[model samples]
Target chain A: MSDLADLYRDVVLDHARTPHGFGLRDGAAAESHQLNPTCGDEVTVRLHLGPEGAIEGISWEGHGCAISQSSASILADLAPGDSPEQLRSRIAGFRAMMRSRGEVEGDEALLGDAVVFQSASRYVARVKCAMLAWVAVEDALLKLG
Target chain B: MSSIAPTIAAATALEESEVYRLREDFPILREQMGGHPLVYLDSAATAQRPVQVLDAEREFLTHLNAAVHRGAHTLAAEATEVFEQARETVAGFIGARPDEVVWTSNATEALNLVAYALSNASAGRGGPEADRFRLGPGDEIVATEMEHHANLIPWQELAARTGATLRIIHLDDEGALRLGEAAEVIGERTRLVAFAHVSNVLGTVNPVEHLVSLAHAAGALVVLDACQSAPHRPLEVKALGVDFAAFSGHKMLGPNGIGVLYGRAELLNALPPFLTGGSMITTVTLERAEFLPAPQRFEAGTQKVSQAIALAEAVRYLQRVGLERIEARESQLAVRLHSGVASLPGIRVLGPGLGVERAGLVSVVVDGVHAHDVGQYLDDAGIAVRVGHHCAQPLHRRYGVTATTRASTYLYTTEAEVDAFLERLAGVRGFFGAAS
Candidate 1:
C-alpha cells in the first residue's frame, strides 16, 4: 500500500465526496455533455455566467470515477467568480498541465483542489479521468459563450 | 486440451478452457506488462498474436509473399494460392463458403462497402437485389444502442446519404437491449437491421438468430458487427443467417489490416464494388472497364498478403482449441467477474449482470470512487482493465452514467486474475476515504 495515498489522496477524495457548488443551476446559460468514449467516463457540465461574462456558477451531474467527480468538485469553486479572460487563461494553463507528458511547472497552489492530482502525471490513464470535468467545464464555457 | 492442465470445473469451466488453451497459442501472452505478469483483461480491445500465427506470416513474407489474383510468374502463383487459401480458412472459420468471404482492410471498410453498395443500389447501379436493399425516406435502419461505433456510424452515414431514418431497440436498465422490442421496431419500413453480435461496452451478447429472423420477416437485410463476438465466441455465421457479416482479424489473435466480410452469394453478386483500382477487373478498354466478381471486386489493389496468412493461422489455432469450449470458458469468466463485482458494496455491474447472457465481460460503477482511479489502482497491481465509455456513447447516455469501468476477459485470463482484480477494486473506496 505504498502511499496508496498518492493515487487516492485525501484531498482528491474530499473534493469528490463533497464537491463544491456541485448541483445544476436553475437557469443555466449553456450546458454541454462531454464523454471520454474510451473507458465510458461521461460528464455533463452546466455553465451559468453573469451578464458581464464572469462565471456566476458552474455545476456538473453525471457518472464517473472518483478522480473525475473530485476533479469536478475542485473545478466548481475556481469556475465561478473569475472573469472570462482569467478563466480562459486558467483553462490554457490547465490544458497545458494535462497534455504535458510530465512536470507541470507552475504555481501548484493556484490550481487549488486540482493540485492533489499533481501526482497524476505518473499515470496517463487517470489523467483523462482528472481532466474530464475540467475539459467539460471548459467546453461548456466555450459553448455557452 | 491435450497437454494443458484441465480446469477445476469442466462441464462448467471446460468449455471456457477450450478457449483458454487456445489462448496459449498466442505468444504475446507469455510476456509481462508493468513488471507484472500481464493479466490482460482487455482482449475486447485487440487480442495478442499467437506464435504459430506470427510464424506463418513471417514464413509468407520470407518465401511466398507476392500480389494476389495477378502475375504469370512462379512466386506470384505461389503468393496467389497462399492468399486464397487464407480466405478459405477465414470462410471455414465463419462457416461460410470460400466464395462468400470478401476480404476488406478491416471490418469498418467491410461495413462501408455494404452501405455504399446499398446506396449505389438505391441510385440504380445494383444488379438484382438493388431495389431490395435500397433505402429512402420511408425506409428505416434499426439497431440497438449496444452497437460499437463501427456498426452505428456506417449506418448513420448511410441514413444521412439516403433519406432513410435510423431507428433503435433501446436497452433495459441492466444495459441489455430489449430484443423483444426488436420485433416491434424492425417492421416493414425497416430496410436493414444492424447490431453487434456482442456489445463491445456491455459484454451483452445479442440474439442473432431471432434478430435475423425478425429482420427477414420484414424483408430487410441484417448486418452483424462481429468485431467482439467473432473473436471470443463460437460463431456459425451461415447458420446465424445474416445477409452480411463484418469482423476484423486483429481482434482474433490474427494480424491487423485484414477483415472478413461474409455475405450471401446472391446478395454479394448484386452489390457493386466499393473500391475501384487494379486487380479487380474483368475487361478494360479506353472508354470503360468491367469489374471482376467478388470477393475480388471489393478487394482492389494489393491485399494484406502476409496478414491474411497469419489470420488464417489464427483461425487454425482457435479451431484446435474449439469454439464451443472457448465460448464456455469466457462465459464462466464473465459470471465470476460479474458476481465478484456485483457483491461489492458500492458496485453496480453494468450490462447483462451475472448470467450466460454476458460474454465473459463486466462493466461496473462504484458509488464513491471514480472509474479512472479504480483503474489506476488496478494498474499499480499489474492488472489492466479498460475504463471509460467503451465506445458506445448512446449506451452510456441510456445507462444515465457518463462512463463505467469495464474488465473484459478472454480464454487467456485466469480465476486468480479475476479475484485479484476484484480485491483491488474493493480497496479503492476505503483508500480514498469515500466509503459510506
Candidate 2:
C-alpha cells in the first residue's frame, strides 16, 4: 500500500476532489486538446493571457485518473500571474522531473502540489498520466505565441 | 440429435478438475506481482504462454533454425517441413484447409491484407475475378459499431479508397448489435461485411451464423475478426460460412509475431497479394513476373518459422484441453464475475447482463470513479486488467462512456481468481470515495 499511498497522496486527492478552474472560459485565446490514446484520457486546456503574454487565467476540462485531473487543477492554480518565460521554465522543470525515472527530487517550491507526482515517475505506464495535463497546458501555451 | 451436445457435456464434466491442472503448465502464474499472487485477468490483451509453447520455439531455434523454403541443405528442408506442418495444425484447429491459412505478422496485418487486396482489386490489380470485391460510390461496406480498431479502420480505409459508403449497424443499450437491421444494411450493393466474432470490450458473442447468412444472401463476402473468439471457443471457418477470418497467435497462448488469415481458396487465388517480393513469386524477370497461389502468394518474404512452430504447439495444447471444455469453464467464470459485480451499487456492467452468454470477460464503469483509478486499485490488489476504450471507441461512445476497466479470463483462470478480481472491484468505489 506504500506505493499506492505514495502515488495517491492527500494533496493529489484534495486537488482532484475540487479541481481549480474546471469550467471553460469564454474568449480563450489559446487552447489545445491533448489525448492519451493508450488510456483514452483527454484534456482540453484553455489559457487567457495578460497584456505581457503572462498567463492571466487557466482552466481545463477532462476525464481521467486522479493524477491527471489533479495535475490539471494544480496547473490552473500555478500558471496564472506567471509570465510566459516563467511558465516555460516551470514546465521544463516538471518535464525533467517526470523523465527523471524517479531519480530527481521534485522541486515543490516551483511545481507546488504537482510535485506529488514524483512517485509516478517510477511507474513507466503512469508517467504519461501525470504528464497529460501538463502537456496540454504546454500545447496551449505554444498556441498563445 | 447432434453429437455436439454429448461432447460438450463430457468436456464440461472433465473441465471441473482439468482447469486446475492446466495452471501448472503456465509458469508465470506462480509469480508475485504488486506483493500479491498475480491475478491475470487481461488475457484479452495477450495471453500468457505456457512452457510447452516456449520449449517448442526454443527447440526449433536451437536444432532446426534455418531459412524456410529456400535451400537444398538439410536444415533448410527440415525448417520448411516444420513451418508447413505448423500451418496444417493451425488450419486444422479452425477447420480450414492448410492452403487456406496464410501467415501474417498479427491479426491486424491479416485484416489489412484483405482490405488492401480489395482496394487493389478496385484498382484493377486482380483482374475480372477480383472485381467481385470491387466497390463504387453507390456500393456499401457494412461493419458493426462493436468492432475493434483492427477490424473497423481497415474497412473505413477501403471505403475511402474506393467510392463505397461505410455503413454501420449500431449497438443497443446492452451493447448487442441491432442485427435485425442487417437485411436492409447488407443489400446487394454491399461488397463486404466485417465484424468481430466476439467483442474485445463488451464480451458480446455476436450472432456470426446469422450475420454470415445475411452477407451471403446479398452475395457479399464476410470477414470475421476472431481475435476474441478463436482463443475461447471452438471455431470452424467452413462451418461458420465466413469467406475470410483473422486471428492472432499471442491471444491464443502462442508466440507473438504470428497470425493466421483464413480465406476460401478461390477467393484468395483471385485476390492479388497484399505484400509482394520474395518467396511468393513463381517466376521473375525484371520486366514482368508471375505470383504463386495462396497462401504462399499472400505470405511474402521470410516467415516467422519458429513462431509458427510455437503457435502450432499452442493450438495442440488447446486441443488437448478441449476448446469446448475451456469455453464451458470460462462461461462459469464470466457468470461469477458478472453476478458478483452486478450486485454492487452504482457499478454499470457493459455488454450483456448477468445471465446472458458472453465470452469470458466483463467490463464495467463506476458511478463516480474513472476507469484508470479503478484499474490502479485493482493493480494494487495484484490484479491486472485492461482499462481504456478497449480499442472499440465507437461502442464505448454508444454506451456514453469514455473508458471501462475489463477483466478477462482464459483456460487456466480459476474460480478463486474470479473471486479475487470481484473482491478487488467491489472495493474500488469505496477507495475512490465514490461509494454512498
Candidate 3:
C-alpha cells in the first residue's frame, strides 16, 4: 500500500487533474509527437522559444495515464524561463533518477515536483509512463534546434 | 466438412473443487505476489503451463533428444516418430489432417508465411498451380477493424506487394461486426478474407460461419486468426470451412517458439512455399529447387521439435479436461467478470453487454483513470492483468480510447480469483482519487 501511495502521490494526482499548459497553442517554433507503443500512450508537445534561446513557453496536448499527463504538466510549468542548456541538464537528471530504480533521491531543487516520479522507476513497466512527456519535450527541443 | 463434435455433455460450469484440483497441476499458482496470493488474469496474453506440460518437455529432452527427419540412428528415429505423433495430436485437436498442419515460430510468423506465399504466387513463383492465390489491382483483401495487428498487418503487406486493395469490415459501438457491411465489402473483387475467431480486446466470438459463407460465395479464401479461440473453445477448422487458420502454442499452456498453421490440404499444396531450405526440398539443383508438398514445404530448416512435443502434451491436457466443460466454466467466469467490472462507478466494459454471449475475458475503461494506473493498482494487489490496446489498435481507435485494461481467464481460473480481481479493481479508481 505504501508503494502504491508512492506511485500515486497526492501532488501527482492534482497535477494530472488540473494540468498546466494543457492545450495546444498557435505560433510555436517546433513540435514533436511521441508515443509509448506498449500501452498506446501518446503526447504532442510544442515549444515556443524566446529571442535568446530561453524556453518562452511549452504547451502540450495528449491522452495517457496520470503519470504521463502529470509529468507533461510539470514540464510545462517548469520549462519556461529556463535556457535550453539548463532544460537539457534537467532532462538528463530526470532520466538518471528514473533509471536509478529508487536508489537515487533526486535533487529536489532541480526537479521540483517532478522528483515524485522517482518512485515510478521501481516498476520497470511504469518507467515509460513517467518518461513519455519528457521525451516529447526533448524531441521538440531538438526540432527547434 | 469433417469437424469433430464435442464428446462431452453440455455442462454449465465446473465445480469449485474441480478447479482447485486443476490448480494443483500449476505450481506457479502457489507462489505469492506482492505479499498476496497471485491472481493471474492475463491468460489471453499467455497461459500458465501445468507441471504435466513442463515434465513432458523435460522428459523428451532427457531421453530422446536428437535431430528429427534427417538421421537414421535409433535416437533420431525415436525423435522423428515422437515429432510426427505430436503433429497428429495437434491435428486431431483442431480437426485438421496431419498433412495440413504446418509448424511455425508463432501465429504472427504463420500469418506472415501465408501472406508472403500469396505474394510469391502473385510474382509467378508457383506457376499455374498457384494462380488461385494471385491478386491484382482490381482484387481486394478484406479484414475486420477489430483484427489484431498480427492478422491485419500481414494482409496489408501482401496487398502492397500484390497490388490488391485492403478493405475493412468495421464494427459497431458494441464491438460487433457489421454483417450488413461485411456483405457489401466481400464481393466479386474480394480475393481473401482475414479475421479473428475471438477478439483479444473485445472478447467477442466472431461469427465465423457467416463470414466464411460470405467469403466462399465470392470465391475468396478465408484465413481465421484462431489464436484466441483454439485455446478456449471447441474449434473445428474443417467445420468452420476456413481455408486457413493460425494459433500460437504459448497461449495454450504450451511452450513458446511453436505455432500451427492449419490449411486445406489442396490449397496448401497449390500455394508457393514461403521459407525454403534443407528439409523442405525434394530435389535441389544449382539453379532451382523442387519443394515437398504442403506442411514440409512451408516448414523449412530445423523445426521446433521440443516445443512441438510440449504443445501436443498441452492439447492432451485440454482434451482430458474436455473443451466443452472448459468453455462452460469460462463462460460463467465471463459473466462474473463483465458484471463485476461494469457495476463499478465510472467504469465502462468493452464488447458484449450483460446476458450477451462472449469469450472469457473482460476489458474495462475507468472514466477518470487511465489503464496503466489501473494495472499498477491491480499489480500492487497481486492481480496480474493485461493493459494496452491488446495489439488491436484499430479496435481501440474504433472504441475511441487509447488503451484498456483486460482481465482474461482460462479453464484453470476459479471463482475466488475472479472475486479477488473484482475486489481489487473496485478500489483502483478510489485509490487513484478518480472516484466520483
Q: By DockQ, who's the top model here? A: 3
lDDT scores for all predictions? 0.79, 0.89, 0.91
- The per-residue C-alpha lDDT of model 1 at residue A33 equals 83
Residue-level lDDT for B102 in candidate 3: 96
Each candidate: chain B TM-score: 0.93, 0.97, 0.98
Query: Candidate 1 lDDT, tens digit per residue, B1-436?
Result: 1122234333645543444565576666666766777777887877788789889999999998777778889999999998888888888888788889998889989888898988888877756656666778988998778787778888898999999999999999777678778878999899899998888888878888999999999999999999988887667787898989999998888888988899998888778777888988899999877777777777888888898899999888877666666677778778888888878898888777564478878888777666776777777777888876777778878877766778888767778789988988888777767677
Question: Could you arrange the candidates by TM-score from highest to lowest?
Answer: 3, 2, 1
Quality of candidate 1's docking, in CAPRI categories?
medium
TM-score to true structure, per model: 0.88, 0.97, 0.98
- Per-residue lDDT tens digits of candidate 3, residues B1-436? 2233455533546777899999999999998997989999999999999999999999999999899989999999999999999999999998889999999999999999999999999999897899878888999999999999999999999999888999999999887999999999999999999999999999999999999999999999999999999998888898899999999999999999999999999999999999988899999999999999988999899989999999999999988887777888898899999989888888999998888888999999988999998998899889999998999999998888989999999988999999999998898888877887
Q: Across the candidates, what are chain A's individual TM-scores?
A: 0.88, 0.95, 0.96
Model 3 clash pairs are none
What is residue B10's positional error in candidate 1, in angstroms? 6.6
Q: TM-score of candidate 2's chain B against its reference?
A: 0.97
Q: Could you tell me which 10 consecutive residues in candidate 3 chain A have the lowest summed lDDT?
A: A136-145
CAPRI classification of candidate 3:
high
Tens digit of lDDT per residue, candidate 2, span B235-268?
Answer: 8889899999999999999999999999999899
Clashing pairs in 2: none
